[model samples]
Target: MIAKKILNDTFLIRNAKVEDAIQMEYVQSRCYPTLHESEILDRNHFANHIKVFPEGQIVVEKDGIIVASASSFRCDFPEHDSTFLEETDNLWITNVQIPNGDWMYGIDMGVLPEYRGLGLSKEMYKARNEVCAALGLKGQIIAGMTIGYGKVKDQMTIEEYCKKVMNNEIIDPTITPQRSAGFRWIRPLYNYINDPESGFGSILMYKPVDENYYL
Candidate 1:
């Protein structure tokens, strides 16, 4: 399905197509360089995502250039896993996606450097939330990396850092904006990703679908 257009038609958000794999790869590389090479999705991975769950992937474009994207999939909460980290090994979309699952697992999102300030990330999430409501999914979940925490890790613990970001006392390049978009911190996830600032940990977050939320 096509997502609602934003920026007065200056930009558009739509479901990912197999043709977008190359641009998606470029954006993923530019956005998360710290991640190990094995964790980055390749062109075939993108095709598989579109093949298995088309509505779960959303992309933004402006002047025919892809600028940002959000990729996700449906999965049930793994009750046996202690931390969300256990459920994210290798960060492969195929390993976790379950077609009949109740929750929407947010895999990753990115916005190219030049397009950072236009609120594209927020718009893409709005589109994702709509998909959740339409699919009758419970809510969106993420293992959110605290990319900014690397700077202050020596001064605080990961839990403390998340609280500060949520309280608005600090701004995490990633977590803070996610909170603004409606996700709330549920717990700390150890070894969630390879990001150094977060000490390889991240915050497990959730945002229940608000049926009344509108663009």
Candidate 2:
């Protein structure tokens, strides 16, 4: 796909390259400071993701520097819920990708802290949706990070926090924007990752490429 310009040509969103792994790592580090090291995708993992599913990975560049990225892979809807590690095959998804799966599982998507508020994440999500449509997949599914939960964990239960976020009673740094991008919350996932900021909880969400999507 050709690079699409946005923000008055300040940013270009396009498919990711193996060479972008190092830069992607930089973005990842800056985007998820509270996340554990093991949970973060390393350079090797990024390279393997592009090799295994280039179409499912994309990056946003600014004058040739990658500032954001999203990684995904095709898979059938899971019969049982699983933690992020088990679901992502411990972040080495080479064996987790299904060649003809019905859904696009969004593994990671983040923009550099400095690039936040520019709507780069939304553009990345749109690109992923286009890939889903092109591949005739059902839609996209993700274990969304509740980046704002940690700060308020002492005041409310995970369920209460998520419910408030859903009802617009509160704004989550991650979930709020994802909701705006059209992802519907499916359920809550506990111990989703080693994320203290999220109180180790996450929300299962989905965005259908087609409005009439059904199981």
TM-score of model number 2: 0.95
Most TM-score-accurate candidate: 2
Q: For model 2, what is the C-alpha lDDT against the true structure?
A: 0.88
**Poorest stretch of ten by lDDT in candidate 1:** 80-89
Residue runs of model 2 more than 4 Å from their true location after superposition: none
Candidate 1 structure, TM-score to reference: 0.89
lDDT (tens digit, per residue) of candidate 2 on 47-155:
9999998899999999899999999889998777888889988887889999999999999998888888988888888888998989998899988988899889999
**Per-model TM against the reference:** 0.89, 0.95
lDDT of 1 by residue, 64-160 (tens): 7889987887899655434333464344567777888988888788999988988998898778878888998878888888888889988998778
